[model samples]
Target: MEGWLGLLLLLVHNAAAAKMKIVEEPNSFGLNNPFLSHTNKLQPRTTPSPPSGPSHLFRLAGKCFSLVESTYKYEFCPFHNITQHEQTYRWNAYSGILGIWQEWEIENNTFTGMWMREGDACGAKNRQTKVLLVCGSSNKLEAVSEPSTCVYSMTFKTPLVCHPHSLLVYPTLNERLRRRWDEIEQSLSDELITEQGYRKLLREIFQEANYLKSTESKSEEKENQKGSKRFETLEQCSVANNELSEELKRLKSILDKNGISYKNASDKTVDHLVPSNPNAARAEERFHLRGDTGDRDDH
Candidate 1:
């Protein structure tokens, strides 16, 4: 029995030594080890990487900002949704989702704004907001405006949106020139000036800086042309004034002949008879002066 016990103890010691050796041995395969295969099989829980670009507004993700304009309060959540609440005594006066996060607006390879879309409906289309991200010391919602029905624009300021040399005290030379060009284009579009006038203005812009100051250097012919333009303008004004006076006098004579007081007439009716523009007034005066004789002559 003692011999059997010694043999059993030796067997147990050998098994224990083998187990210890296996545990102490370094895993040469590292992750590929059969023992660690289960660990490798388990996929890692991936955390989303931060948004990449000069404007790192991803730091503001999941954060919210608010602004109040008049009776309405606007709430903006980065990488989320925007909402508007009407101020009232009740807990829920009027609440609406303005927009949902769509994508980042990129300009010049930099993130400049956030576009949110597909919100509450307005007419046939849905509401949307474009939040312009500007640099500031702290994150804030500056203002919210609905430039059109169901379309919203927001000015949002955050330090995260700031980039190297983003702000400027004044516009660049190119910007100023572009603005002037736009103004000239607008003038032409508004019919405030003719095509010929636009070209003249353009030429004046490109002329020497002292061109306006050197009026004395102009030729006599050019001076005479300028005087003619002025005289023509004055003559037109005088003609329009005379026509208006004659029309008024004629109306007054007729009213007196009928023994009707001018004061009793409706001002609107009088204004209707007297056209707003000189051309229209002239046409109206001619029509009245010719009367039935003109119609018979036309036939």
Candidate 2:
């Protein structure tokens, strides 16, 4: 009887040990996780790893770094997706459409750098985080442009995720984007307008008073910067005038010595050379003579 009881006790102990659940909870894939305290299988431990190396956050992608090198032509476009179910990251770059060189500020792995749209002014306006997705028939989602432009962005698991709403589809989109960029560069390399087109443009530009004034203002600004007329000091100007006067006197003396009739500059009159009936000249004379001393002869 005692031996039978001992045998039954041992059997019960073996069964209990075999079926015992020591750890409270585990991952769905059957990996034992120490951070999890729940008995539920769906929940997994998310405690920060020691000496985090991208897995806790992420790592830099070298290929993405090159995409943002040109700030002028591209803008910030982030592609968020998953890798092998364990990794999820964002590939960031410029939108590449209607952006400029200065728009790209290379920070992060920078698959895509800062966004520079055509109208983006300063950091305030130009930073656009475009959604990355594949565009095809399987899924159809509303475009962010229709209801809200730049109001929000999406993080996709794959190109297939955003396929419905996305204009570009992952790797295919990359080639399309590159081809489009190449075409644009080729087009811009050539003179955009024909001679006739340029002539028409010039005529139009000159005909508009506002445009002409703007151009004049720009030209004047350039002149002011590069070839501005510097003011001479009073002493320098006075000395120059004195030198010119002496030079004139010497020239007159030379002419006299040569037996040529010479008149002093002030004594010479330009009235006889005037065209007598020039209205434009009269208007110019009136404008210039407003503050002129009457005795001073202008030759």
Candidate 3:
């Protein structure tokens, strides 16, 4: 009986060990750090305490991508009124080959973020604060912005000046709260933080992510609007070139009557053989009509 009981204990130990997995991740600097995956997924079991999340001064901001070429653009709208060409920008934050509009957070050297759970309940919706980690910070953090993936993130070359003051995954803090939760998991007699802590952190982040910061972006919209305008100017330049070429031809006929050639940039003596009209201040031909490369799009 003693040997049989010992065998049962060994089986249980092996089963428990298989439940928790540490995944090794390769980062930007090519270092591998281990991340622990939660064995049991937690669900939000209660309403937000403050209902409306807390107000924060700073906001989390990063790029959006449908497909990242130059500027991360995800949508294309061919509205002739909004400007000329089709405008490409980030489209859906819920579903794309790449992920969606992720709500990412940052603080100190630690980082954490979440992704949408793949299933029917969350299968369609972009992972809101309820479940999504855009990116995080930690001394041993890895950054990967990859091909065919919409990774919203921020990287601090140095550690954050101040540590984040919040519960990790109250609602769900990624790395920002991972360290705290790691400690809490040990303290709650092997359970992670209480339900109260998770909700508290969730509420805090919901409010925090929604706030407008002093470092807000008003220019990004203006800039995109400006980018669409250049395509319009390219059309105008084409018209201007045609008008100049026509007038130059008329002037050349007048000069030919007096047997003169005005073809070179450095030669200006042909002025003496021009017509006497007051407008004989001769309309100029574009001697250097350059080819249109879409350099105007840079502005």
Candidate 4:
């Protein structure tokens, strides 16, 4: 029984050792190796190598007034004025101890050139610098500087830096008047009236004038009729007043002869003295009979 127990323990020890060995072995697929960190092995290369040469340079030909070369040949032309002139300059790669120039060539509007720099003038060692130049128009070199030892860079301003078309001259008074007259003439030409249109306009004006005159005459006739009506009303009121006065005088005479005293009543008492319905009807009938009698006498 002890031998069987020892055999079981030995088998367990052997299995654990085999597991550890499998874990310690280097991964052939390199999926998970502690020595090969995930960051270093899985990460992709993103940064590019440093350029072995210098960047391209561009300049206008005759406009570079400060350009002074002793050993190098330089030529320039205005890109805007000419299309056949060469506009690019190259540096000799083997000429100067610090920098060398290469061949300069131009194709259409683009200028290409190559250059090499062996070292800097400030006691710097060989840098193996290369340069490229591209030609362009309307670009002005604003400044050039060498911030590092033997390294140079330049700043350029485009032709559109300043607005040239914005500059304007004020016109004279006569010029402004002439322009205004020109505009008026153009408008008249554009709105030209034909003979038929002119005649139609004249007819419309005449019709409008006649309509206005007719309306004025009608208004005047209405005013005259109204005034005549007012005059007739006044005459009727005067005749009625005269008749009333005569009637009152006759009444006074009758009262004197009868020896009866007359007294005026207040408006409220007079209003209360309105006749009854039968009395009013009798009075209206008598008025109609009197009117008929007057008509018969006139006839």
Candidate 5:
């Protein structure tokens, strides 16, 4: 009976060692091993977030603007979906959702329009609409029309989308100041601060901005005095003057050594001598006269 128990123990130990070896190296059993296959299938995956609308377009979010026509009324919500309604005497009946926000249509590094698709079915394919955003005094759904079968076009106008064409294109000084004033006004309108507080804030801003500062304000005179004090000591003034003189002398010596002579700087502003930002300046043609970049759509 002892001999039989010893043999049984030896057999149990051999079976455990073989099981451990298999567990340590699963590849030796081939890629068909169930344990290894299960682990390989359990990979971590990340879910992607939805795409975002442009800054100018995002400002109109949550507000639904409508355009009423003789037959139907159209509604649009920025960064959301659009819908059409049948104009009834009692209440506007829901026609159908025109389209949902998909992606932005960009041109020349600017978001010119938006593509809203996967909406109500027309016949075979689903409805789709292209919304064109333009600069205007206020937000309005200008118009809507069906260009092709089930394909629609919409024109939206808002001041928030107003921006210069390119980085090289700069707004006029009046436009810049107007935008600044609008920002201040918007703060007050939003009730972010009281009127008196905003006025005080404007005064502080004006004091900091050299060009905007009042001539009658003592702060302007103080700024002038501060600038003058940069060379308060005679020794400091002499050092600056000597440094400028030396720079000019060195520049002149180099020009003379190179056998190059230039006339004195012109008294005029010499605006023509300054290189243009865009060397080959091309004026944007009138919208009607321009070539069809395919962006043009009805309404």
Candidate 6:
């Protein structure tokens, strides 16, 4: 009996260990495991906010002429004196392609660059290619030039050169409220007793109070307008109802004076009146006996 009890305990322990091992395994489908799928699938991806300053990239393309060819053909010599038909190349950021002949850098709206044409495999080349560029906020490709033979220059517009303060980022309402609350808390906790501090605090308080007052006043004005309009509508309806009641009374009096009676089908009271004139009495009796046919003349 002792041996049997020990075997039973061992079997139970093994079973419990196997169950724990299964539970501890990572779930591949993420359907039955809460621990493995705690992240929400519907959550949106987080993206970095845009920089608070102007920044831009531009693509440029154009032709180039050598100094000798330009001077003879156009009477103006180009900065780079390449062979007559050599094409000018500039880096295109969008295409991720660099100009084979030139390398350039731009900083603080100033541009400087160097370039050279490919020659025969074993040839030494001159470093005569230089470039200058200028840019502004208008976002226009303003100019391109070659100051000397085999050199180039260009001017264009870029937002990145604009001042940081000019860029705007609108905060959400919750964020704005949180920031305002933080500011208020900070102001309340400050112990500085300077005149400037007092003035600043008073200004902020007054501004907040004024904003609240304006909102309240606008809402109250709107409610008052709505109430006044409703009141006017009710008064008009009441006056019209009174006029209709008076008209009905006048009509009923006219009917009574002519010895005519009116009754609704839904009325429980049944009243009969005797006509004073014999002719009217006969007509009334005929109307009651023969219904509407008594009122129609037989042609």
Candidate 5 has an lDDT of 0.56
| Model 3 per-residue lDDT tens digits across residues 192-278 | 223444433333444454411112233544675676534357778777666556545544564454344554443322333333454
Q: What residue pairs are clashing in model 1?
A: none
Best-performing candidate as measured by lDDT: 1
RMSD of 4: 42.3
TM-scores for all candidates: the values are 0.37, 0.18, 0.19, 0.16, 0.38, 0.18
Cα error, candidate 4, residue 67 (Å):
8.6
lDDT of 4 by residue, 273-297 (tens): 1223443443333222221111011
User: In terms of lDDT, which candidate is stronger, 1 or 6?
Assistant: 1
Please say which candidate is ahead in lDDT: 1 or 3.
1
lDDT of 2 by residue, 191-283 (tens): 222233333333333223111223434675588678433436888777766755764555344334333442334553222222234443533
147 Cα displacement, candidate 3 (Å):
6.2
TM-score for candidate 2, residues paired by index? 0.18
RMSD of each: 23.4, 22.1, 26.7, 42.3, 24.9, 37.3
**What's the lDDT for candidate 4?**
0.33
Report clashes for each candidate as comma-separated counts: 0, 19, 28, 11, 0, 13
Can you tell me which runs of candidate 3 are displaced by over 4 Å? 1-97, 101-111, 114-144, 147-299
Cα lDDT of model 6 by residue, 1-299, tens digit: 99999999999999998888444645343223435332232121222121111223222233332232322211111122222222122121111101133222322222232232231222243223233333365445344455754343434344534654322211212465446544434433432122334333333432343211233335765896786524357789788667556645553454355465666444433355456565455445433532221111223
lDDT of 1: 0.57
In candidate 1 the C-alpha lDDT for residue 232 amounts to 55
* Model 5 alpha-carbon drift over 4 Å, by segment: 1-51, 89-94, 165-299
CA shift of 255, model 5, Å: 42
**Of the candidates numbered 1 and 4, which has the greater TM-score value?**
1
